[model samples]
Target: MRHPHTRTTRRRVLGALTAGLLCAAGLATAAPAAPAQARAGVPGLADGLALTPPMGFNNWNSTHCRADFNESMVKGIADLFVAKGLKDAGYQYVNLDDCWALPQRDADGKLVPDPARFPHGIKAVADYVHAKGLRLGIYTSAGTRTCNSAGFPGALGHEYGDAQQFADWGVDYLKYDNCNNQGVDAKQRYTTMRDALRAASRTTGRPIVYSICEWGENKPWEWASGVGHLWRTTGDISDNWGSMLSILKQNLPLAPYAGPGHWNDPDMLEVGNGGMTDTEYRSHFSLWSVMAAPLLIGTDLRKASPATFDILDNKEVIAVDQDPLGRQGTVVSSAGGRWVIAKEMTDGSRAVALFNESGTAQRIATTAAAVGLSDAPAYTLRDLWQHRGYNTAGTIAATVPAHGTVLLRVSADPHWAANPPAAELGLDASPLLEAATPATLTSTVTDLGRTSARRVSVSLTGPDGWTVQPASATTAATLATGRTLRTAWKVTAPPGTPTGAYALTLRADYRSPAGERVTSALPLTASVVVRPPAGTSYLSGLTWLSATSGWGPVERDTSNGESAAGDGHPITIGGTVYARGLGAHAPSDVSFYTGKACTKVTADVGVDDEKGPKGTVAFEIRADGTKVASTGVLTNAMPAQPLTADITGAQVVDLVVTDAGDGNDSDHADWANASVSCGGAAPAVRGD
Candidate 1:
């Protein structure tokens, strides 16, 4: 066959012979973003490792070790996954979280399956998973002890050997946790297991997907890409709306790190959990799809109701997940609890999601033209959950439910020939009613299979008394103007922009060199809030910064009841201090609720002046502990400087600051500012 590049090669040779001409033409330039290539599927797994997002049953949040982990229960769920076509939909991995391991290892330094729950042994169970065409996943900690207090006989000094055993047992996915990899960097600890998995894979001749369960310690995004397929980006998500929303909010900053080869894990799904309503669960699924997160179901597949299955099986909704684009959408604009986001799909289509996250329903209106399309292309508009299709003019006026979402897949309208346009321009899902930036008015013109436009001109009538800046422009007739050339300008925070919602007339004129003129006018609107209205605080009282999960620093303080005992109650830490909720329990047997960031921590020890050790308090931070902050001291006088320390990726450190005194009135101590810096932390793994 003739080589197609021969002529191009000859041209290149001639260009080499005529370098000046080639330079003058400027035809050569670096390729844009490396010619979009097909992404290789996940490593050491089938090509469809993540076809539609991993979905299956989990032990925690559902079974929760509540006596439902028997072999029959596992097989029953497996049967349901198959019967529900979940496996056919690409939900293959059946994962187990903490609390499944036995309390002790055998005499040979090997993990022993709990005989009471698994008489056939874990290997036999894994065989059952493979037999059912589903892969098996298991969880374990890098520490000597598991999160649920089960001691690992081989975990203390046998991480690699243990990984080999998991591979030997035919485990396909391993959620390696950071329970007690003390004195080691979190990245290092995870890396240790990664290497172990590789070695084990070599020995067992079976590929395993290494899942780093560091609980968002360090900043997983920073190093997660090269280390694991997926990393948890937030603490465990609960079945409540607050938990789901909080995890979503926490993942916003980690978007840049998500891609085809890697994902951001917002923990597991709580679709069938009891804390939230069906609407909230739908919202959860909607947001997760938008965020491109892994869809690991933490509910019992066998017991989920019809509503749960409906939410999970909506193909329209799942399309967002399976979209080859693999790009997570971002909130382009937000106002008054309303949000507009844009997501790019693999098929070159964009999904615009308009949502009302407030307490009541809101009217979401937009023009296809405003969303940057004119003579609007054909669109297949459907409510993802409702599965109803509505074909209409360029404008869309949908009454969006409160805390609900409207996802629209907008593309070139193809049925224009069949349906004559009554208007010159149309709007798609563009939230023109809530424009947020000066760039909102920007629009991209389509040539419509014809020559491109030379110049495009647009104009807007001043709103009421408002004035237009740099108001007018002249352009070549390339744009068919009458609204066909989606043209609009975003409202700016103009010096005198109004303080309330307002609408104005927008006009566009496309003139050809031959003197042909096309003009059109439509209503353009926007909201201008000089300052955001104030309301009751969403989060109340003292908010302590949480320590990073896995390993990091712990800010020390000696104020607010620092004693030998550790109480989980909130205490005032001087200076600005924070603490993350480390998985480790407080000495007082209570769980700490730090608000995701802090260096200093305090305990709630009320005034006990009569006690001999009135001012006595003690706090500790260890390498094995998840939160890491510098040691802080509290005194009656003199300024205190922050303690200097280095927290390499994933290393655990103990932080302790205390105030103690013998029986005496002079025994007084004040503590504050207990927090940890995430600079040296592991990258969070996000599954979008």
Candidate 2:
């Protein structure tokens, strides 16, 4: 693990020559780009070596420095590539990563393959690969020793000789590393080998794809196009998610520098390595394809699973990488750990991927306009994995599973035979949280895509401390293109939690349009708001109007409680009618009128909490719901403010409150001891 098989050298010649190199690229764009052959006038080397980012198998991921890199191992993989139909699918080269050469060069100063490892010699291995219609690839370091230094003399001082030997051996690719170079100038050192490769090609007429394996320290994308066919953009890539994500970040920014002949390599593909889940590997392949990175397989091909083959041999997905345009995709939008990467394919259409890196599934969306084609004419869309095709006006959306991707190919053409059958789930689900009501999130799903989804079921989840229970997802026997389903979930916030939006996730699992045999999940979050309700306690305020009719909230009147309206301070009230949480807001209405009256109706009201109202709580006793006995406005908060209304002939009353002149500012009008007596009877109204 010293340097992930290769170390990056500094940027001396590379940085200095970056500007000129970029300029030359601009001129090349005028000519038709030959993906198989485009050389920017670099001397010696021929045009078109690593056209389309060299596809083949490598031995690093499955077999490390266990001396398992013998000729037999490589030969097995090369044969499997053909047997598995990978050759027809465009996999051409079979590469050996490191420790493949003998301890020292022969006395004639030529590199040698290990006698026991390659009994017939490296040339014979090359012949074996070539006979199978596959190219042969070999590895070495620029330093005095390889990463493992398993005895082979490094190519530090023998660049020309090593390149010539590889050419003579019929090697189709050379992965030149930078192991123990003692901090040499990366551009200068790589430039030396570039010239050597050119010289070797002239002398032998064999074109070897020169891979600049100096890692990414020199920013190879800025200058490597002039020297090699491909250059490593990141150190090493692991099979896990975190490692892969970091490596992808390094490669993404260098997309513009990648073209037909030169590519930005983010290490090799770790597919079929058994290190990650199937969903993760799918995401890996999708990302690499969009980036247009090298598809060098780093796995034990002999034992690859059926799923692995399906992922690797995905032709439609592969076409995105091998597009004649050779442009790498970039993130169009990223939110909630979901990313939408878009690349324009050679066909004037686009290839987009909805990638979810979050631990849970996520609903990711992107319009045709977002990917630069909203205004284009009618187009055909294909889901690469599901192999389903359909027509679209232009927008594409999908609910991606965790660590998964929804790969799409958008073509500008309106006609096509059945390209692929793909099914997508569009679930509109979210939460509406209020302090006054129990929280519930509802998710309604509709499948309008081409394919029919099977056995759709859903589940709900939330963050820590909060409780959430989602109704079981309705099992749909066949969710055809026009079918719809819905599910609901209730959320409960733990006591003492502040008021704000919390993510409540709804996950749906179902079979794709393919079948009910395999399952996929879609996740989306509903922001559940948790805060105490505002305004008067239902018990304190008599029967009132609806929420829209100025019926404010009723919350606990505690210290720091939101008893005031529009986010104000708490209020204090001394009354048995209201509970721990009480809210009294002005601009409110209540009625207590019935025609049977008492002597006088009296009540003592104070500011609900300290954040008292600026208005007065006036009582109007009426004979028929009309105002008779008036208390006017009691705006005093000192001592005792008693409001008495003479019942005389009034059998009913109307209690209306309003903020003085300041709209509803400080409208925390608490009407304590509020009553409407009839014949020495209690106020005929009570609130909960």
Candidate 3:
């Protein structure tokens, strides 16, 4: 992803960011930035294009470079945008991604639209889109050839020429792709196009929104603010539950790099696509809205049903994306499949998502204090999707269907907290923690209050003689309510820290939002028990799972329904106990005996119960980062699939249960009699 902002543009952005903090809070909204008159206020710079995440219709997802997406199709989508109420909802750009050009450049080395497809050419298409009160977008590449594989040559050596040609054709947006660039530096090649576009704009007085699509490998967010309006944060997204969720996991941490004028693009919206269920689609839209992602439409407008329009044209949710504050929502709390992601809205309120990633209906609840809904005896909550309102001042509770979301806009009076702040601490130990080796200890400090908690600090207390790092840790900033701060400490017990089950006193010190000093204490007990020497343990117990408690409660099953409503009966081998979601995303982990290499891992796995949720799951085993083995798309009624993987020379083995094509709701996946064998590198279970 190329487009680097100019020096002056960066200065203005940084200067304006000084007030961004206020925008991020519910205190105020940032004014929309004014575009620079000249590129860089100097000469040639691709200044203002998208003051917000550019939204519009893109034909690639719905048509995928097929022969059908032509001038008529593009014009039809534009008409639908107006007819279906998409135009007034802030979705204006009509972008053409890949395969839009002739296979070869003209004899004069100029690019041209395919005659067979557009008969009248791209200029006519742009005119049609402009006539409909909408803007038209075109596509190109940074390399010698485009990503279409058999598409036209890129703008590589013809940046200026292509720029001039596009200007002549009256293109309003450019989707610059990355493919076949003969080893040219990504930044250099992209910057070349930026200048090309700037020259065209200055000469023609028409601005084009440049989208950098380098696919996140170039760390575009690190240097891609002013260069373009938005940059893809990851690889292209597939139309499936796993692809959507996977991209989200990678894009969530890039939130800080997104704001007004520039954004972290997680690719286009796939709302009406048939890959995921309605519930999953809601989560997709809800996440993109709160995360400040570009709200581009990637579905066929003509075929989109009313339900699809309901999701795409939700004005209330759209307002959050178009909020002048331009702040992305962050994950405040996540446990099991229940997640709380919150965004501070402009009107001293908040837009929140209570998401259930499980396969069954779950009780999603959170207190007003958790989201900084302080100083109010009561607050009004508006359901964004259902278009209804509720009054609540305590815990906001709802039963979200499997893979469903309960999205709400809370109007809370922002003020100092009137009640004492509550604190929660979670302790996690290293999977390889042994008797003599130093292990990293992680602890989280959460302020269960309705306002910001100030001067927050936490410490862990164990036996007096234990070896612990940084006896205490202080947060660099005040803790926002519902926000959890994780601090890690290196701890070691020399067989003298009073072994066995021990309670760690995790105490916190903080001041109330009103500046009143307060102190809180919470205890986390982890067995200081000795992990048996190297080769003596199997992953037969919950203690072996790396993050057992991070999710909702997971139960070991003897019979399928023992944990939840599933039909999985433990395979009669190895051990009667099998691990499944029990209505949760049951992710488990185990380490090989440090003394030897794991030769192989074996398991009999099947989808938990198809009779009820019929949800799907994939069982994956990875040693280090190498995927050693996996059972793809496990479903109910399918015989237990036998799997094996060579984890040779690996010290850790991880079993990850992921949501199948559907959401994780009722995805009761079972790994019966799962175990790994140690051999080779060490004393191969000596045949004494």
Predicted structure with the largest lDDT when compared to the true one: 3
Q: What residue pairs clash in candidate 3, if any at all?
A: 3-227, 336-551, 336-552, 358-665, 359-665, 359-666, 369-449, 369-450
**TM-score of each predicted structure versus truth:** 0.55, 0.62, 0.59
lDDT to native, each model? 0.51, 0.64, 0.66
All models, RMSD in angstroms: 21.3, 20.8, 18.5
Q: Which digits, one per residue and each the tens of the lDDT, describe model 3 over residues 414-492? A: 3323444544454543223455567777776675555567788878776566666763455736876567777787777
Relative to the true structure, candidate 3 reaches a TM of 0.59
Q: List, residue by residue over 1-688, the lDDT tens digit for candidate 2.
A: 2233122222222234333432453311222222232234443233767668778887887887666678888889888888888998899989877767777778787777888888899999999999999999889887666776353566766777788889999998988887666456888678778777877888899988889887776788777787899998866676656456657666777878887888889889889887677888999999999999889888887788999999899988888888878889988987755799999887688899999865444678777778877465445777888776654445577777656898988866646223222334534433434333456566655554455556777566666866777665656776765466776666666666544445544555566544534333344433333211222112234332111112233332322222233443344454233332224454444433222334455555544545433334443334333455555555535423566666566433445444342233233555455544444443334334
Cα distance off (Å), candidate 2, residue 481: 11
In TM-score terms, candidate 1 sits at 0.55
- Once fitted onto the true fold, the runs of candidate 3 whose alpha carbons sit more than 4 angstroms away are 1-46, 413-688
